[model samples]
Target chain A: MRTPLGKVRNHGAGAAGTGHFIAQRSTAIALAVLAPWFVVNSALSLKGGNYLGAIDFLTQPLNAVGVILLVLIAFYHMWLGMQEVILDYIHRPFTKVLLLLLNTFGLIAFGAGAVFAVLMVNFGA
Target chain B: MAGATRPQRPLSPHVQVWRWHVTMLTSILHRVTGVALYGAALGLALWLMAAAAGAEVFGPTHEFLLSPIGQVALYLIVAAVAYHLANGIRHLVFDSGAGLQPADASTSAWFAIFFAIAAPIGLWALVTFGG
Candidate 1:
């Protein structure tokens, strides 16, 4: 399976592959628990059209932390999943790499923005 | 990088070529739902930012969620989550080296489909009718 270029690279899909697999599954397990809580919390928060109350509910320490964890994990998991999809469907090499890079940057930017928002709300910033 | 003289490469069986089966359909839907969830995550991030920006921002965000289109979108997201979660658990089981047998795999695929639809609809009904 060694191409001359791969031989020059010297490492296979070893540790990185394991880490990727573990991350996907662990996030899956975490979301299985967190997603339900998220849906229910969102429903209760916004159901009555009390926007301030909804903000207040999210600002509560536990709920704030939960939303942060949920968004962070969800975004990371999303990047991994999208990577797989792009790799499968985007057969052209350069375009595929470009798309993958875009996916990574997009996820990081959004995840950071979300976590920041949660903190701002929590601290009244 | 040239295209005109590129050698013919063997292509794998795809939707147009393959006969459909439960596992095949489930596999495709899993990827579709995952992609859908990625878009949903962006909306979630924006919503969080809006809420953090105070009432002026949160008002429109809240109104959007209660709007008819938002309600429909929310319900679709709920269904997508349910299906993805159910299939993801099945994937984990397969990763553990169980459920790889044809019969078991088919059964689980069907189960995932059922659970995905039923869970979201059931929740929608409860939320709509209950307090």
Candidate 2:
């Protein structure tokens, strides 16, 4: 049970503390498995290639799906990591709050843009 | 407590006060790489957008990536990723309640550092020379 002071100070997790921790790690584990594949495949796809070839490779259903997953998960993980870093290092309360908001919004925008790009490629739009 | 003025707190010991060590280097590198990856997200998004947008956009993007400066950037990013990934695995190992021994921890840090160097170099060797 949180008191008024706790609520005012934002002491509680707003029901997200444990879930955020678990999700960050889960995404990290997922990335650990996916990242090597991503790097290798990306390099291979681009071997002696031009722009259209790059598009062709990415638009393939398998590559498109893999990339979409990678972008979303990576951004989510990045957001969590950035939030932690900012909270740890930024001592000014106002600046910390601003940076935290920027981190969240910025990641969301990147994730949305990346997924949109992948979908555009997938659909040949 | 919320309404009262807070007392000034002592700053914790940081890198300035500490001697260099492999484990400390690894830890700092993890955070640094994490921040770099966050910035790289924008580059990635731009790459994807260009790809989806067609050759007019992707041509320049791909060209930049193959250029000397771009290749250098790519190599650094890849190195960062390798380090972060390898150290992340070490962290997971620690989380599992193993590798708590100082000797084992140092060994793992060295392993992570070695992997960070080797992974990108090995990857590029394959990319460049593999038939």
Q: Give the number of the best model, judged by DockQ.
A: 2
How is the predicted docking of candidate 1 categorized under the CAPRI scheme? medium
For candidate 2, write residues B37-96 as lDDT tens digits.
788777988899888788788888888988999999988888988999999999988888
Interface RMSD in angstroms for candidate 1 = 1.3
TM-scores, in order shown?
A: 0.87, 0.88
Q: Score chain B of each candidate by TM-score.
A: 0.84, 0.84
The parts of candidate 1 lying over 4 Å away from their true place are A1-15, B1-17
Best by lDDT: 1
Residues B1-131 of candidate 1 have per-residue lDDT tens digits of 78998889977878688777899999989999999989998999999888888889888887888889988899899989889989999999999999999999999999999988898788877677877
lDDT of 2 at A50: 92
Residues A41-112 of candidate 1 have per-residue lDDT tens digits of: 777556666667877777789899999999988988999899988988999989998999999999899889
Which one wins on TM-score?
A: 2
lDDT minimum window of 10 residues, candidate 1 chain A? A1-10
lDDT of 1 at B32: 91
Any idea what lDDT model 1 has?
0.87
